[model samples]
Target: MPDTSSRIARPRLIEIIAALATGGLLTLMVLSNSMMAAHTTPLFSSLTAHGVGSVVAGIALWGVWLLRRGQAEPIAKRHIPLWAYLGGISGALTVIITSSTANSALALTGTLALGLAGQVVLALIFDVFGAMGIERRLPRKNDLIALAAIIAGTILIIFARGAS
Candidate 1:
């Protein structure tokens, strides 16, 4: 087998841009969710967000279906485990937690920084364990270093905000 440890795939320019854009969108989403939570409640906020998202997704899917009416082959249905549906629960929890934290001393920046750190740690665990059918791979030295740096930054931001 090839030495894949040192052969990390470099992200393309477009991929990098897309990632940045997604980050921006996430920040906006968190902000909006938190605001809704502030006025109403976390549960209400999550419900509203998901309801809107479902409608938008349904419309988009309908448009795609109309555009590709007979051009696309029928997709084969695969068995999806019931556990896969847990993502909706996880998403609701995320909104609740972030909404609560963002309204607290953590604020938006601290919330996002800590959230990023959590994501890095979970991603490492998922990669190592091949969770949810993800490819199993040992984290590279650089990955650990990056994780450490992100954690350190998150801690600093959280503490700095608290100190002010």
Candidate 2:
């Protein structure tokens, strides 16, 4: 039988908090970009918002890295790759496309759903291929089932938006 814990450890609690925080931040980012796009060109809004966000996040990370200088170990060479450094480019593309989509017929829910579905599919492929230096973890049957459901839901949301 598996043992059940009465309380969470600090590291586990931190992980939970980080996960929730990421979700909250992403929600806010989508809403913010959409709102901004409503007032200006999607490309301009994406550029401005993503630019500021990148600078702020970079500065914050720099500060943290400075403070942690001897306390934390550096990333191992095996885990680092040129492609891994292209996350900023990916973020830029994501912001541009999301802003444009959010301003189009898809609106918020449809755009987000479709984007998430695409991401889930790509993530599964990446995991299976061990792309970008990640350890390979083959997708299970449940993953494929979940992806199908997500795609179906996205299609429903998009068509429902059109019908309304």
Candidate 3:
């Protein structure tokens, strides 16, 4: 029989790509926010950056959607939930908060540490609650352990002033 492993591997490959893209985005945010803050106030910089970025990203996504229109399933805007559309509001707030907080005594690493810690906790809450159409997944002992480790590490990083 012919091997059909490629189909089985496709999801994992897509997950890997998504992870890489997310990581890249986080890194870019760190660098850009830091640099932008240098020229003006953090809040102002963040607003400008996010405004420009949103426009560029919107255009890029639209272009990509247009190009791939025939190859993939058409997305139904009506089927998307109202909650899903509100994510941009949260994202805009994130840019403001993260930019204003980062590099303001906390520094990049410390800011990122605390941010990641908060993100994990919130994500766990969302997962457990099955919020926003996600499937419910209760946290286990291992999840607690991981969260503890992450919190501990973040605390350590925040306090370790001499290391940076």
Candidate 4:
């Protein structure tokens, strides 16, 4: 039998914590930005795209936590470099800068959509070909299809909101 302990390590735990914290912070930033946007002309809606993302990321976190607690007690998550986290923060800052300078609602929603798409893609890729302390947690093909469908649905919802 394979030595399971060797596969899991401390760095992975740190990544999980960092990812969770980052996701939460992004959610807060977007909602607060939405309120700020409300002061502008029809630029703000009650439902910000980041709110949806908060749920998605939260679910991802829950799944990871469950896996660690139950099936893989000692499983450490992948450790991402400081740069990766900074990259996301930079993207958010870019959105802020753009929104401040010009007609930014369009760009903001598009950026948010793109960000969500990236998460979906990363999760799916990780599920299909496990990486970064995350294992292929789903065993069935249907799970993959379901995840894809959800991402598609989320995109449609955001687009529909923007249309109105």
Candidate no. 4 TM-score:
0.42
Residue range with the least summed lDDT across 10 consecutive positions in model 3: 2-11
RMSD of each: 4.0, 7.2, 6.8, 11.4
* Local error of candidate 2 at residue 70 (angstroms): 4.6
Taking the tens digit of each residue's C-alpha lDDT, what string does model 4 give over 1-164?
Answer: 54433233233578879977997897787677767677763234323444666799999999988777746355675676676655556555655555554455555458658778766777767766666554545435665576679778878988887678
Q: Which ten residues in a row have the lowest lDDT in candidate 4?
A: 2-11
Candidate 1 deviant stretches above 4 angstroms: 1-8, 74-78, 97-118
Which portions of model 4 miss their true places by more than 4 Å? 1-29, 36-106
Most TM-score-accurate candidate: 1
Off by over 4 Å in 2: 1-24, 69-76, 94-121
Instruction: Give one digit per residue, the lDDT tens place, for model 1 in 50-119.
Output: 9999999999999999999979697876678899878888877887788779789878677878788788
Work out how many backbone clashes candidate 1 has.
Answer: 0
TM-score of 2: 0.64
How well is each residue in 28-141 modelled by candidate 2, as lDDT tens digits?
986887688778877877888878978999999999999988886866755456777778788778776776687788886677677777888788777676765456666567
* lDDT of residue 62 for candidate 1: 100
Clashing pairs in 4: 12-77
Mind giving the per-residue lDDT tens digits that candidate 3 earns over 23-76? 789888868876877877777777787789889999999999998887968666
lDDT of each: 0.79, 0.73, 0.72, 0.63
Shift of residue 161 alpha carbon in model 1, Å: 3.0
Q: Which of the predicted structures, 2 or 3, would earn the higher lDDT when compared with the native?
A: 2
lDDT of residue 102 for candidate 2: 72
